[model samples]
Target chain A: MTAMTAPQTAPAPALIAAERVRKTFPLPQDHGGVFTVLDEVSCAVAPGEVVALLGRSGSGKSTLLRIMAGLIPASGGRVLSRGAPLRGPNPDVAMVFQSFALLPWLTVQDNVELGLKARAIPREERRKRALAAIDMVGLDGFESAYPKELSGGMQQRVGFARAFVVQPQVLMMDEPCSALDVLTAENLRGEISDLWQAGNFPAQSILLVTHNIEEAVLLADRVLVLGSNPGRIRGEVQIDLARPRDREQPRFKSLVAHIYTVMTHPEADMTRMLAEDNAEVERFRPLPHARAGGISGLLELVVEQGGTVDIPRLAQRLRLDVDDLLPILDAAVLLGFARVVEGHVSVSDDGRAFAEADILRSKELFRQQVLARAPLVAAIAETLRQKRDGTMRAGFFLDLLDEHYPPAEAERQFATAVDWGRYAELFEYEADQERLRLPEPEAVAP
Target chain B: MLLAALAIAAVLAAAGSGIGIGEVGHVALLGLATFARVVVLLAVSTLIWTPVGVAIGFNPRLARLAQPVALLLASFPANFLFPLAALLFIHAGISLNWGGILLMALGAQWYILFNTIAGAMSVPTDLRDMATSMRLRGWRLWRDLIIPGIFPSWVTGGITAAGGAWNASIVAEVVSWGGATLTATGLGAYIADATGRGDWPQIVLGVAMMSAYVVGLNRLVWRRLYRLAESRYRLS
Candidate 1:
């Protein structure tokens, strides 16, 4: 990618550097083995640069951001802050969160002044600095309001103020707008980009972790797509557009389209990716986490246009980024309903029929497809039917799934199975009791 | 079990073997002494536990070790501890006044410990990450993040510990160890003495006074603190 050859404009100082950062979560009963989350992930943010990590959910983008913030230690490799190896949380780095993470007990002024209070700043100076920071984040009048009393966007403004009050060199944001309404999110995004462009923002550089393709192109100078399953950088695209880039422009639309392709390119090589481990993994590995509603939603959309449509056009029509669209696509592919060929998604006959059918008939179709294709779901249903009690512990299936995939991913897939299986009326999972029971034989058609 | 005893005592009073209305003042004065003891015991236990409970709460390994030991101590029965306490303090002549408070505290402190542990463990990880990114560690971490986070739990612990201290004072006040006996002048001692001598009037009076004191304390004091914790310091 041209991102690798971006010229060194006066060799800007590196604010944050993540070199081969790897994180592994320990398994409960895997003895010495561990579940690798991020493997050999490397990136850096230089002065005047904004890099975005674009990927699907459960892709370790958030974990990578936390590593950059020095909030958590990597299992292997190192993170450097301001050109020095960082051992723990560094004062020069800060983060904004998806949840805002403001202290609900504290008022906005106190929340904004949190870092200053921790550093033992004198009371008078702390108040002045906190207010200035609050005003900078456009939260001037809401200083005395409690976090619970503020809107979601206002609360996040407090989050931004708290991070900026410390004047961090590298500011890391993990899905900062993911929790807000579109209008509020767009307003805040415009405000942030405006501040950064006018040289009014305090942070030297920002690393934004988001799954929105247009958001990545609009906000960052470089975009990196993190591939799931031991998240690694699969592709990088450099955005060369100028400030305040128009979305209606042909170039901006093309850049967004190009990223969609790069993110999905790995799916074609998925068999090769699995073959490196074992041939059985391609078929036996647990499915990606997706809901029946999401799968059906994608099915209905794809089948609407005579059961065939280009993906880029579908994405444009649906306004879904690759991250939001691909899970449903993967679910369809896993269920034998649709397949992606070249740049187009073509719905199978069954998918089209299911889309046209009413509720009961569609569920019947789903039940048939799931029973035929998903081994874990079929096994669960069979075990429940054979047992006199008509129930089995969820841990049994979780352990079975773990034999094929990493523990956490296996757990996610098992949860997805429970959702789809329940939707298809094949099995019912009681989360509180952790039991899976067979569906009622005399179940109503509805 | 104790509340049931008090209720049965209430029914007996309605059945005619009740405390005479004239001796209410004397029982009220005695009730004051027992109430004073409960306060002293609660204050001392809170002082010790607020630190230790909070420390154990923040550390998982320490919390695991603390759980079984604290449970054992809490359920050990304060009456059993008084014999050892009386023996230790009799020769030094400190067994009469402060011995009751010390014995009551040993039973009550665990309420504060376990509840505080639950609160500290639930202090959301995102908030902790905020602390780290803000470079707040060590003393700042404890004072700013952990302390305020545990306030609601502390209020809950304090209320339970206060009630448990009152229940404990009956056995803890007039403790007899081996061949020796120590007595403190409080409603707990008065009731124990009355029950021993079969004085129905004094027993009813004492039970009624204690019920009054506990109900009054719950409504006038602890309830307000509990509401404050729920409204202002609640994690949600």
Candidate 2:
């Protein structure tokens, strides 16, 4: 067998590039704060290639296309065409809207001639070019017919003829076939493909936005899937399936399934990384502080005296905020070490039985001791860091403490009247008098 | 009356020969029928003309041409020209009754022509474009598009022309000149003679017969044609 060699072809440069683009809207405070509809998204389309931006409704795909077209400005980032920034709708770009925006009073020939007329082409030449474009779209004899006289498909063909007459470098279709019936849409697609292959038109690239996944798969060189809730690029699937692709092929189904999985399960693989990060953080930090006793020793003090400890009371005793207390409680709940119900916290029956009966292994005892010491020790370390050799300003110190530690812990650790009073009076702090009065030192310290 | 009928029937038979509607045998029958029909047709046309003429006068385009034409014809005082009509008929060696019918026909023809043209000119732009885009041009365009486009005006003009013909008939039928005088026995003559003798019953009968013929012909023909045109041709 003869040695094989790859075919030599010139590489096409990127014609359109969108980098870290974002669009957002300020929501009414009544409806719940500012809502981001599109977050930072990046995409690029090469010359002569067709790319389909696919998404469900409200996914910001059309907004992105509009931004790329320079019809609207993006709230963040930039879109560049041929290494130059896109400012507004360029003369080299033409867009076909879903509604065929043909002027009713104008005949097919006049509608087709609009773009050239706008450019101030001479009348005779404009007519000639208009007729040629009309003929190309197979509307040869309908030059004088007005929009109302034509069928829907024929009207869309007039729209196509209008766009084609301009000979723009980029043809952006905003769901051009969505309004047409399937057969008409298919015929239009075929006509578009044929025209592109013929290479007579100036439109070097086509960028289509569509909700139909199969349409994207059928028409695009690459399909970009956008996900909702602050829309971002979920995945890009290269459609290497041969041109004139069969939608019935198993390979196509597999590719569609892959896209669906990427769109639906965005955080599937992220969960493992998140869990690993949590483990590493726990390994480096010292354990939480526990009372100087084993489970039985603690049980004797609380249960033997018929005492109670819910999440809030436990948080109060530990001098921790509700937010900081929640993760620890969640972990404890997950491990079956505690039970919380009806805003009341308690040890589970199994937890109580285990505490009383378990002296099973020294390692198990050590683990429980570490778990109990973690929160209190972390809070103390944060407070020390805030104190900073006693040189930090009091107001700054409280802010630092609040940042690092929970509100309850900050309140307790910095409870001195002199410390809080000077800072509060400086900032005009409003303190809850009943819950957090300055302690009388002689009464509290002894 | 038979002589007037025979005269109109000869003219109609000659005209009908072009369209192949009849031959000589039909012409003989048409002579009697045409005479009676001319009298009836004249009376009927008279009653229909005034209301339809007013409608035509209100039309924008036709009113410009129709106002002057109708006024000129209506105020011409055809009755004063009986001696002239008689002298012409005798000098030309044609029957006087033939001249009478021709004069009546000319008076009616203008109403139909003006109204028809006005309605045709009033066709909307969209419908015009629809016709053009369909490549309707020339005679086909005239027959299929223009004729239908102005049909209501044509009907209106036809009704007005009918009345004009009746009004013309009185002056058309009576004639007097030096040593020559002629009169055809029709409703117009009957009305003239009754009025001359102050015969109320005869005058009332002539007027009543003419009014009945006008109402009957309009209800039977013009109304139905107008309904069809309004339904089919007039743009909403």
Candidate 3:
């Protein structure tokens, strides 16, 4: 790994280091007594390096970022700043939150001066530094304005000003652009990039958490991708593109595509393991957010576009995030309906046939495919069939997934399963009652 | 012309009956005395309860414990406690003048306490964290965060306490239980004295003066402070 990436092989003088960090939140019942957010995650931010932790919603990138920032502690590992263990809020490390985190009653000047005040800086100096910071962030005339009076972008600028005023050694930003519009986000991103390249800011290094792959590629010197369900580093790419990197460049687009490909398709250890063992396949990796309509609609789109399409262009046209679009792509790959390679996804013969078939015939094809290929759906069907009433609580499946994934992700995965099961006419879901029942053999078929 | 003639005639008749200009000096002085007692009682309540109220407000368990107990205490009528206070004052031979203020405070202080507790709770966790991270502790922490956080609540409490104080004076001053009577010289005592003597005109005069004082104070002082507190100390 060191030989491939263009950087010093040995660890350089580090600004902030997190070694084998693990964070686990306690579950209510003490079943396992823990819910793992990140497991055995090791990373170091050498001086002058901006590292981006890029992951989707449940990937726990923000948790990892906070642990490194000393905002939260890791359950099992050491987080050090300049070789000192971080026991609490470190003055050397400041965080800019996505929510702006400004006290509503405080003026812009007061909000910017808060960290300094906390550090017990004298009045005259705190005021001077705060004003300078406000000016630096282009908020000069708005010193007395309250947070409630400011626009979202202006409030975020105040957030930036607050962090910058502290002159921290390590600045951690948790998706600072996430709450702003596209244009506003782009504008802020450009300003930060300018500050970073010009060495105009105090922090020697920054730890940025973002889900947008393009943002990660655009801002970071290196990007770390975390896998879901006990988030651990899945892949790391050192972005070697020159400073002021043009988004229109082929190299930039290719890098974005590379990150997208890695995000959408992880090495399917569960699939490989299940294929090898062929026993108790229900205990395989938890389901993705693959709804029946999205899966079928994606297949239909792939078939219509000559059975092949550019993944990025397809995502842009469909207006689906990689987080949303990846699961559908993964489901297609799982059911042998499509094969995704490089930056393109192509439909298989069965997928093409399903696209050509009538709605009833397509659902019939879907039922056969899901029951044969997807273990979770088959387990639900089997469990419902075994019950005397041919029904079970939806919570039964949810709890099973929760034992492996986070409770939220488990709930979402089970909902996806319910949607697929219902659309395929294998199971009937009563949402208001939250019960799943096997469909009765119909007297009249449509 | 008839309305003006009738008003002048009514004024002349009232003065001639000794229920007019002569009583204004006496009634106005009595109103001032009662106003002074209300002010003193409010000061004492502020000094005693601000810290206590803020303390209970910040502590969840303490706030929960105190809520029902304070409400219970506040709901217990001040008139019901007059007998016990009356007995003590008579046995100790304590002057009724200053003692009436204690009864006034008793009737009023809980309003301040509960309001401060509410304000203390509403101080957002982020502001507290900002203080802690800044290493602000002890008096500075209280001065910067707790006081400002409770200011709006304190103003609300003060308004209610002042109103309660005025009402309590009617019962507090000129306390009577069975055969004994303890009297304090104020509008309340004046009212009681007139009632005992069956002087309906004096009773109306004392009541009208007390209402004027309470309403005037609320309009001139509290309304302004409440507005300032809402703008300055409210942590949205």
Q: Score every model by TM-score.
A: 0.87, 0.39, 0.70
Where does candidate 3 stray beyond 4 Å?
Answer: A1-11, A268-285, A331-336, A353-356, A372-407, A426-446, B1-236
Tens-digit lDDT string for candidate 2 (A411-445)? 44344322222221211123432222222334222
Q: Which stretches of candidate 2 lie over 4 Å from their true place?
A: A1-11, A28-33, A266-446, B1-236
TM-score ranking, high to low: 1, 3, 2
Q: Give the CAPRI class of candidate 1.
A: medium
Candidates 2 and 3, the one with greater TM-score? 3
Question: Each prediction's Cα lDDT score?
Answer: 0.81, 0.59, 0.80
Candidate 3, residue A8: lDDT:
36
What is the per-residue lDDT of model 1 for residues B127-154, given as tens digits with 9 covering 90 to 100?
8889888877777777778778898888
lDDT, model 3: 0.80
Q: Give the 10-residue window scoring lowest on summed lDDT in candidate 2 chain A.
A: A1-10
On DockQ, the stronger of 1 and 2 is: 1
TM-score per model (chain B): 0.85, 0.63, 0.89
- lDDT of prediction 2: 0.59
When candidate 3 is compared with the true two-chain complex, its DockQ is 0.20
Identify the candidate with maximal lDDT: 1
lDDT of 3 by residue, B115-209 (tens): 88889888875455445544557876776677877888889999999998988888888886679988998988887787889876676666766
| Residue A174, model 2: Cα distance from true site in angstroms | 0.9
